[model samples]
Target: MLPDALPSRWYPIFSSAQLRRAPTVVERLGERLVLWRDAAGRAHAALDRCPHRGVSFKTATVNQAGELVCPYHGFTFSPKGPCAHAPVLGRDAKPPAMSLDIRNVTEAHGLIWAFTGAVEADTPPPPWFEGLGDDLRRCADIAEEWPVHHVQLTQSMLDIYHVGVLHRRTAPGSGQVITDFTMTTTEDEVHTEGRLGHEGAKGMPFVARLRLPGLVHLDVGFGLHVLVGVTPIDAKRSWVWARYEARLTPLPQLDGVIAWLGAKYDFTVLQHMEDLPLLKSIEPAVPEPGVDRLIAPDAGAAAYLRLYRRALSGRMEVAQ
Candidate 1:
């Protein structure tokens, strides 16, 4: 679920594969922006609007310089976003004077990340995953647009009790409770952060634990991290983007297991189906300035919900 607002967090927006060749515009939360690769083969994100006529640069052409040229009036802008030239005017002539909020773009571990809000390069890295090893294969992508909020989907990750009742395969409880799980709730809007690691567990890593939301970061062992990004397309829809990162060994080596694990997690679509009835069933949440009391499992759920609420609030303030 993409929020009606934006978060100041740095999230994975696109994979390296999708950002190649031509420019692509992602419309999210009622906002428009463009992503394209430069001549040096570096991916760049910039405000999609052409300062000249407010036309989208995403619909423009990629020039020999690899800069995005607006299709409407043929206005070309550099990766830095300064209008490099106006086709009607010769190169020697004065170019359009404008710039876009070209955020810093970084490609890592086969993914492209865009820093939203006031993220600092010096900021500490995101959480570290365990049991993460090589051999993660990209079998199928379960990307869909949600008709609800992004937090709704994120909160679903830390839901352990529902595993047995909702998702029957992974943690099917034959009327028996699973092993002990450690769930911690802190004073952060990031409500839920818990882990259920069963030793000699049945699966790829022997024991699996929750690492991150939507990411499904499960550390199978040291240096092995499987991260999946459940990106939002808008307040009503989003995409489920996942990747298997190989840190110690090459992924090609464990294609079979990775494929198996990928299949194991194939319930993403099913998960959405589960959410469909609930999300669509939600009759536009009642704006209660703030939430009231929360239950036990709700403790973790509340933390994440609050984390996202604050994040969206900070963004809305800035956008205003």
Candidate 2:
């Protein structure tokens, strides 16, 4: 979870393919936002509420002049969000003092991002997925809306313990026992080093990295890397997006088909199906240490909470 007092941060609202000249509604960090692009293909983000009647402008449309026209009253607004026209008022008439509350928006790396917070504060650029660089070939992407809180969704990805049990059929760990857990935490990242199975029998060492606010990179070896990001839609809902990338597949031509099918079975059908029923069963949204008896395997979750607290205290300096 993010702290209220922290400065604005860029959060992904839509994939590049999802937004166009039409207004699209997206909820993030507990606020409803409207996203659209202009005739020049410039992107914009604003509060979905129309100032006049407090109705959502999500159903609004863009006019020939490239302004957002409210569906209820035909009040038009510029991309910067000041009122440009009103149906009842004449063309020469001056618009009222009301204006849409627009926020900072940017498009990059095949995603649309919005900066939400105080207007005067300078927001840092969105975090880059280092695993998306030239070294890896991004083969497939998928997103799922989970009923549980974003924190729970994040923890499930970091726990190596669930692999053997929850993913037995889909992931098939070959009866491997996971142990020898170690975790290191910094203000920005949590690094975990562990063994997959019991000592000497093909138990490959595993390394996982989690960046602040829930961006993950799992190095499963064999040129396979898994990237996961969780964006809070509200206190109870979240949008989880993941990308499967590989570098050295024996058959490059079939990589796309293989990645898509693997993600469908292992991620959606196996892992998430197993996690949903269990995570939703937890009583409180944010559970305390004593709520459940946690063992060594839960160190990753513990580290995540510690880092979250440091950030909440406003003591952690975010690198721009």
Candidate 3:
């Protein structure tokens, strides 16, 4: 989420590598940014504006000194965003750090998260963090994008409505499926949690919950964790980035299989392919203020959407 202040920033932006193999310019909430990796290999996000004269630095070419330089006046700035030295001015004068607005940044789970708010150096990455990176050599879980508003896509993960219709063969259904669940919410968050008592041999329908206006963390089977990271691209579009990893399952000897099976069971790709059309066709409907149009089974759906709208109101910058 984001801090509702002029100086505050949010992690509602792109994950690492998603941008590219190199630096890129990303826009969110109407603000442009220069996202680049420093010489130390640390990822950094800056205001994208050169301190002197306000030229867009993301478009500025990188100079031999490893600093971003504006072609118009030859003013160079470091990765930290301070003017390294103004060739037109003098190398003797140093730019004040105060003049540069540096964002709190961290790269994890393949995302380069930055907060415009007063973020601490230790603010954890999105809750989806699970040893994910570009190497692709790590344990099976891979990150990919689903073309849909992140919040909507994520909510689908916990939406029991589809668990039976879309994935009738999986948990919460296993046996023709029943229609009973609960969706509750709070001021800052909403959760849809329920269980599918002895449906088949699948041992109870494991248990699931969706916390919105963002973040969907679900448990498919015996501690197998499926995390979906959502980032809004705009009002009607966004990214459904998810990580299918295994954790907390009581099957250690089958850990590898559990992870692989977990990923497979999630059928992440197959599920999204089917969901693409529906999500793409649906309108961008932001829940109205003080409305409770929920039915008996509409528990979690309503709660999740409400919390999500609150998240958006806080200025969660959409991850590009």
Top-lDDT structure, candidate number = 2
> Looking at model 2, which ten-residue stretch has the lowest summed lDDT?
1-10
lDDT of each: 0.55, 0.73, 0.55
lDDT of 3 at 123: 48
| Residue runs of model 2 more than 4 Å from their true location after superposition | 1-7, 119-122, 133-137, 174-176, 198-200, 250-253, 315-320
TM-score of 2: 0.87
Off by over 4 Å in 3: 1-12, 16-22, 27-32, 48-74, 88-101, 108-110, 120-147, 168-186, 196-203, 210-213, 247-269, 289-294, 310-320
Give candidate 1's error at residue 224 in angstroms.
11
Model 2 per-residue lDDT tens digits across residues 79-196: 9888988878978664779799888878866677766554444555676666362222346677767787877777777887577677777677634566667888877788887778
lDDT of 3 by residue, 45-100 (tens): 77767677777765666655556667667776776657777675576776565244
Candidate 1 Cα deviation (angstroms), residue 314: 5.7
Ranking by TM-score: 2, 1, 3
What's the TM-score of each model vs. the native? 0.72, 0.87, 0.67
Q: What lDDT does model 2 reach?
A: 0.73
* RMSD (CA, Å), each prediction: 5.4, 3.6, 6.1
